[model samples]
Target: RQHNLRIKVARIFNTYGPRMHPNDGRVVSNFVVQALKGEAITLYGEGNQTRSFCYVDDLVEAFLRFMATGDEVTGPINLGNPGEFTIRELAEKVVALTGSKSKIEFRPLPQDDPRQRQPNIAKAREILGWEPTIALDYGLKKTIAYFDGLLRAGDGDLARLAAQ
Candidate 1:
């Protein structure tokens, strides 16, 4: 059975940055701390899986805009950056910024992971006039600094296996 109700769904994609689970192991945060600690960065499969990330700030703005719109604007909207990056590239950037001795390691990709995941935000651009301004490098640096602080203050290893 289905209720005859109207609603809008925002299909948000991968988001990253600080405040993320320290031992999340969800790639971005994982790679950041691993690089900071001079550890091996893990990549699944061919490391060609594409992903577009939006900072929390940008995501909040997008949500606000979506809420302000009228019923006519109700949509299956996509809120995320269009800038795509491969797993390998992301790992390299983290290593570069942190100046760590981490190396890249590849493993098997997970089941049901999309090979490509860039949001076609043309609709958002034309409708919401929203696009990500914070470059990945800048965002990653901020995240690295956040983790560095936690590590320096004796917060303990973020990726400790038992911490999960």
Candidate 2:
């Protein structure tokens, strides 16, 4: 109010979908690319760390909805799916969805990586009436298909680089 400007905030969580950088080093992209290339899926810690993934399309929809809200609704709302899953679960799903023979390889958990991460989207639901509708399985399949196409289109080098 000091600046007399209207502002809104949305705390976006992990999101994945088509057109994601194949080597972004994020979990979703990492797992999808590895599975598609038949490489080992690398997991840090025990792979039990939990995260809630929102599809890009769903997140984008929330952005539009949030922006259309009245100025009185200025908020720092959480925009993410509340359906949480373990990192191992996500890696296994990617392997199964892609029909890859990749085995999971565990390493020490990275320093400062949270053991669990989930969004409390109550504000989003009450304010924007928004929640993600895409299931992780469905979204993973779409991501796998996207990476599969990318690898097949001579981007395999990039995928290989990511694995290293």
TM-score of each: 0.85, 0.92
How many clashes in candidate 2? 1
Q: Largest lDDT belongs to which candidate?
A: 2
lDDT of each: 0.82, 0.89
**Candidate 1: where are CA atoms >4 Å away?**
1-8, 157-164
Writing each residue's lDDT as its tens digit, candidate 1 over 1-164 gives: 18846566787877777777778767788898888888899899988988887877788888888877877787788989999999888989999999998999888898997899899888778878887788898889888887887777675665453234
lDDT of 2 by residue, 35-150 (tens): 87788999999999999999999999999999999999888999999998999999989888999999999999989999899999999999899999999889888888777777
Candidate 1, residue 9: how far the Cα is off, in Å: 2.1
Clashing pairs in 1: none
User: Candidate 1 — what's its lDDT?
Assistant: 0.82
